[model samples]
Target chain A: MRRHILTYLLFAVVTFVTWSQDTTAVSTGRHITPVRPSTNVVKQPGRDVSPELIEQYISGDTLAAERKAREDSIRRSYPRYPMMTSLWLGVNFIDPILMAMGQDYASVDVHATLNMWNRVQPTVEVGMGWGKTTPEGMNFTYRAKPSPYVKLGANYNFLFKSTPDHQAFVGLRAGFSTFKYDVDAHYSNSYWQEQTDFTLRGEGSHAWWGEVVAGLKVKIARQWSLGWTARWHHLFSCKDSEHSQAWYIPGYGPRGRALAFTVSAYYTLPLSLDRWPRKDSNYSAIR
Target chain B: MPLAWFYGSGTTKQVTVGNVTVYAIGAPGDTVLVNNQSVNELSLPLRVSTDRTQWCLTFMTTDSLFVTDTLTLAYRPIEYFASVECGAMYVFDLQQVTSTHNVIDSVLVTQPHVTNVEQVNLRIYVPTAQQ
Candidate 1:
């Protein structure tokens, strides 16, 4: 009976061991999910940029770039000084005519000019001039008086951002006058000197004159400015004659005179912009 | 821009332009014409004058295109007479011409029933003797 029982136990043990080994083999045999060599991590959306970057775009960097571009362009252009369309007023020298015969008197001129370097300026000037005819002992009257002249011209300046002081300039004048000749001038009740004095009876003739001028221009202040000008003029053809015999005229004998001269000065003024207008590069008002 | 030479005062003389001399001869206040063209029709003032030694005259143009007349008379004591005998005489004097606002090179003279006369030479008229 004992031997039969031992055999039963052994059989049971063997059956159990076989079953366990079968389960282990099944477990190692198959894998349902396939293995991949790389990780599958996802990237998150950007949400943490620094505030300074945003502020720089809004405040200065873009503006600075635009400014730099403009500066470079200006540096590449040619420099130019534009004409100033202004009225000028300043002091000047004048040469006067003393003879009706057109000879004998070449007068010294001293006067002031106004509206010198400003736009739409009005000016008035007074001057003392003296001229002489040859052969001084004749019985003709000769002298220069304080004469006033009106002049109109154009003034300009250059304001190339690339240059210094914005060069200033003015030019080409058209002038009108009541300039006249003194036929017979007497001094201190003395008989007029022949070379200095003369005989002609007529009122001064109205004349039209023209000139070309150039000058340096500068701004003294934000609202004030200054200029130094040089000008040349032609005292065109005028008509006159020697009156009576022994008129005692010298240099010209008995011919009409033509006078021409130059004027130079420094223009100064108080600063005021009450009526001045802001204008474009070409002097036209900006719309 | 042109360079202009202007003679201000002197005796008026007839001058030619492009080689042509024109003249109109008549008593004072007589209407004259060149090629049947009336001179007064253009309305430029003509003037006459006399100096101690010669006669001076000039013609003026209106509007810078015409001429001015400044005539100088010879200072002959005989010319001072109120009336004179009838005759024609010619006298010449040194003449200088000028312009105010235009180029003056030639002169034009209009005669009664005659074609317009033009001259380039400077000439002045003075009778040898007053009648």
Candidate 2:
């Protein structure tokens, strides 16, 4: 697994480097200012207005009107904000570094994602996921209980810029994962050992997690886009609670720490009230 | 049907030790028979069954085994087995017995695709008198 991951990273770096060499400037930097035309101060006979002055005045008025029209056209061409919702079929695998601590479980993660981005493209997302675990497989210790987890998180897109048809994003996420489960205590005492008793109970705990991601969204058809995201994640959970001392929830394992590498693919659809509009040439002539 | 079950699948075929008949069904591939006549065998990689409808067992004999075939054994409601894994057979040591739960010895056995694995929840029938 480690070798496979390293190979993929190397391949990605090579591809990114190769793609960056193109100087097409599909990128934006600081705002570019519009150049102003030179003004002519000349007077005309009878009307007290010079032809040059009238032409200049008309041009100035036209330019101001065109600027306003352009702004309005851009607004009409693209929605001020886009609401997006996505669903993904994901496979998640958790490998245990500490064999004595717990075993690992891999499952198909079903997720529903909701995102809203403002004009500057500030995006926020929340996902709901559910998966299954191996009951008595590997190094798992059963407290004879069911464990469930809920994940809540927020992401900030530092830079978001792309054509109306496609979107590219780089973002960072901070979130919390909470689980409820139970763990059985092993005893050496004969009375306890002889009974082989295991208690079924509920436990609750949370972990603070962060991830950095870069992704691309490509429009496939009307109202639909396919997106792929690669993320590196780090999570830290309390190993033992000060109030209730326990290694960790049964299914989740000891809280000490855990890390996961994940990649996701999603199908997204626009949920905004207004859709992308075509640019109008008339708006340019007005100015 | 009277259902008889074993823990997992693919254990070495157990042979009779002297006149003592060790006719038992625990793992898949365990051969069973009546006297020297072969009866039935099972499929590989057993899975847990919650519904009594899914539990099945067949038998085969060693000698007089003119025909070899498999048949589903009846489920003995008096007996219950869960569809949960118990690791390999070797590593598990009988821990204890509770009012509702029982701990038995586990053994680590290798299968075709898997490495050393443990069997979980091997059933042990404690007589009423013993209990």
Candidate 3:
């Protein structure tokens, strides 16, 4: 009888011990059910984790830092400049030279351009023009009064990423003028041996045109640059052409053609944007 | 071009005029366009400076009689743009035409619109008995 009682007592103690262990696990928020071991499935971590995963995380962070450092070094290779780079005031000399040589048409123009981030240049040009021509192999003698014209345009430099000392650029322009002109044309009849002359005049006339320009601007001296641009133009609308075309189109050179050229000398005027620290690179003291 | 067709017994046909002479009157030397030629068709040019044109036509008949007629034409000159290469030219719209009836019977205004393209713009008919 005593042996049976001892066996019952031991069973009661074992039952109580199992019940307390399950209750402790429940309070601690641990799973009572066994979890399947899988490499893909993620479980709530305990205090201990494999060292392999910890090593992977440390190496990954180091690799990210190294990649960022390499990228930053490569980026510093080019220039780092701000917007509103500089301003240029220029005067064209080609037309005046042509006029002095007794050419038919001439123009005198002064231009201003604002350089932005060494990439874009917004420009404006104002000028006066005149012409007189007894064109070779033609019957007409053409003449034009001194007229004023204006051109507005923008340029894109191909070498914007490089130094601003030399630039290669292509631009587009919209030009306008108000001008007056006259033409005297004589024709002789072969059959009657009679010559007749027609006198034509155009006044209060306005003309608008477009131009595609390409040029090279090179630094010739400190704060001075010499630039040459070739302009191919198309006359969009001209009130003078309906009566008689203006022989000279002020900023546009001669009428009835599509091409002209300009060689200009420029003086740089640095603005507040140019006050940035430029000593970091070989920038040639452009400001 | 003004097409002058001969009509005999109500049939329109080509009949060559004999000893044809045509000249522009107002020009400096009376520019002779066709100097005594036998022709079935002729093309005439107009003056650019004025709206009126005068032509003197002299032709011989079958009976060997020379008949002289004066053709007066008035038009509205239009300044026409031809092409970029050829520039501009003057074209005309025939408004009124009058002719002296010597051997010519009547003048019909066929097509009044004038262009550089070659087409008949006037019809000159000689008398049926003369034809």
Candidate 4:
């Protein structure tokens, strides 16, 4: 089906270019283009031969295919994405929504990425998070005020050669945060013959972690886009607290948990729009 | 967990605390966990309410010296989920340990995190009679 479509496309382009003087609409089926009276027609000697046959063609689009082939050819010869492309500022919605829904822990983060050649994106994220709750069926009340965290990473887009309307990327990030919280605990020590109740205030802790991310982003408007990323994070190291371990590390989520997720919307800022290779370039389109 | 006591000055042979009464400092109305018993090893309950625990070891020496020594432990009380049936509990992560060098010379926290595993969490060192 595709081959037939391409054949029709080639036919239409040939006919259109050859008969610019004719004012007839191009149709799908094979129809001889009418002679404009200025062109010469020759007949073959064979009995069953077509006399000056004019072919016609039609299809969805070979424009993209031809452009891709040309781009691929040029990429094979010249450098790909040789210039700085754009910068994207992203806002996360999943965490904020979950936080509003009374989740135990959540964050609001904004990130920025430098889209280099639509191939690699180096990014940085900064956010403030809070965790305030006593888990159901637990006796202690844990509280942490809004704490700040930062993450630095880069993403490699799998569809680098394709249009920049969407991306499928896998990336890595190094995250860090330092914060303080208070845990109010009330536990009965039967052996000690007492009911203990007190609060440990100003408990400080710092943590470092790494995340492996895989996500997809699609442009919705000219400058607006939405994306979702699933992240697998591991606590690399945390400053051990003698009173208690960190229940939550702002951006990284729960202390011992490994999996996390986020949905984000991006506002793109074009640093420099990439112009495709022009006809004057070394790998210009062939006639 | 039971913290094993040892004679720390040099002898490899383990020693026992003769006629020692052990009680938490914050216990109400003279409540004694160990009442004048020969103690080689004992399990001490840490308070979940606070980060510091102090225990008074009243040693009845052979010469009738009723010497008193203090054992202080500083730790982080971590909330732990033991099991569904047992519910949540507290575990101690030992941070700092010290003892007045009267009869008790020093304190050694062997395995810091106090959990359900029945291992030595601390080694309370005392001078030998030969010293």
Q: Give each model a TM-score.
A: 0.33, 0.34, 0.65, 0.58
Taking the candidates in order, what DockQ does each have? Answer: 0.03, 0.03, 0.17, 0.13
lDDT of 3 by residue, A119-186 (tens): 89999999998888775666666678889999999999888766677889999999999988766666
Q: Would you list the C-alpha lDDT of every candidate in the order shown?
A: 0.34, 0.36, 0.75, 0.77
State candidate 1's DockQ. Answer: 0.03
Candidate 2, A1-287: lDDT as tens digits: 99999999999999998888653454554457677555554654332233554454567786755565555555444333454422222223222222224533321233444555522333334332222334543423433233343344444343222234465666566655455544432212221111222322454555555666666556666655566656665654443332123333332333333433333444554455354332432222222
Give a tens-digit lDDT track for model 4, residues A143-226.
Answer: 887899999999998877655668899999999999988878776767666565667788888888999999999999888999
Off by over 4 Å in 4: A1-79, A277-287, B1-42, B46-118, B122-131
Clashing residue pairs in all predictions, respectively, total 90, 40, 0, 2
All-Cα superposition RMSD per candidate: 19.7, 29.2, 9.8, 20.3
Segments in model 3 whose C-alpha atoms lie over 4 Å from true places: A1-75, A136-138, A190-198, A202-204, A240-243, A273-277, A281-287, B1-19, B26-29, B38-51, B59-69, B75-131
Chain A TM-score, prediction 1: 0.38
Candidate with top DockQ is 3
Better of 3 and 4 by TM-score: 3
Give the winner by lDDT: 1 or 2: 2
CAPRI band for model 4: incorrect
For each prediction in turn, the share of the native Cα contacts (below 8 Å between chains A and B) that it retains comes to 0.00, 0.05, 0.10, 0.23
